[model samples]
Target: MRFDLFHTRVDAHIRKAQEYLQAANLARIEHQIAADHHLALASMYAQRVTWLEQELSESVSRFSPPFRGVMTVAAEGGKRGAESVVSLQRSAPVSNG
Candidate 1:
């Protein structure tokens, strides 16, 4: 094998650049899929918590007649939020979505 220091250095530089590019590509992909797209799950949980809080507040209302309208609205909003989450999950790619 011929040992050309200049060619060896160039080859090393090229390899390093390729590795850096590969790392950058991987980072971009990872950033795009942060949390494995479990954001929908988090959103679902948050909406559920909100609904529960509203329900609890409505139940403990001092008024003689609890506010059914507020409760109903909260329930529907929670339901919609859950449905949307499910929809999003279903629509996502099968693997690593």
Candidate 2:
């Protein structure tokens, strides 16, 4: 697939995932503020927020580097890290001078 299509799809996916992340945060706040508040409910939603964040990160890592410093490979680790670096290099624009 062309980089344009890939970028577009990835952007769309990230936007959708962001909505879920926001919902998770809202749930955490709501639970925290409720009269029957239980820390566990807020904690559960907080964990969901973390999971969604990682999901978004992994999704971004799959894309062509949109720009410099896309994903710090160290944050990814292992084979996936190597693959993202290769993908970023390959997708890097060729400069003419």
Candidate 3:
């Protein structure tokens, strides 16, 4: 699924969870059974939101490129020289042959 759509669905679930919680709170004063049902629905939505967030995080990390370094430009004698200013170590294990 597309990231935007996934994000929108997550947001919708969050709103549903919030609405259910509000309903549960309101129902708690008059009907305990109704309150319990709403609470259960809220919990289900909350769990789904948690799962979706974790999935989104993992998906982003999986697709993101590893940061290697930053390039900086220096001027000397009217000439531009490009140099890597910051270098980062690779996250993956390096193998020696």
Candidate 4:
């Protein structure tokens, strides 16, 4: 999936979890069953958010070294030029499929 879309999905899950937690807190005084149901939904969303975050972290790590190297090179006044960046990109393994 596209990184932007994946990020958006993660954000949505986080929002859903927060909303559910808020609903549970609000309902706890008057309706125990409703509060329990909301808490369950919140927990499910929280778990989903955790899983998605891990996936994102793994995905970023796959390309992090080359990108980080390029950034460092660039920060040092680009003495190595763009060719080094290209080579770094080419050398990185393509694991995502």
Q: What TM-score does each of the candidates earn?
A: 0.46, 0.31, 0.35, 0.36
* Weakest lDDT window of 10 consecutive positions for candidate 3: 67-76
TM-score of 1: 0.46
lDDT of 4 by residue, 18-56 (tens): 999998887775688778889999999999989976775
Model 3 lDDT at residue 45: 100
Which segments of candidate 4 are over 4 A away from where they belong?
1-30, 64-97
Total clashes in model 4, counting residue pairs 3 or more apart in sequence or in different chains: 0
1 against 3, candidate with superior TM-score: 1
Candidate 2 TM-score versus the reference:
0.31
Residue 16, candidate 3: C-alpha displacement in angstroms? 41
Looking at model 4, the pairs that clash are none
In candidate 3 the C-alpha lDDT for residue 29 amounts to 65
Q: lDDT, candidate 1, residue 55?
A: 73
Candidate 1 residues 23-80, lDDT tens each?
9999999987987678978999999999988777767575433244445455667554
Which residue runs does candidate 2 get wrong by more than 4 Å? 1-36, 67-97
How far is each candidate from the true structure, as Cα RMSD in Å?
18.7, 28.2, 24.0, 24.2
Clashes of 3: 0
lDDT of each: 0.68, 0.67, 0.62, 0.72
lDDT of 2 by residue, 1-97 (tens): 5457444577778999999999999998887678356676888899998998788778776765642234555444533534354332465777897
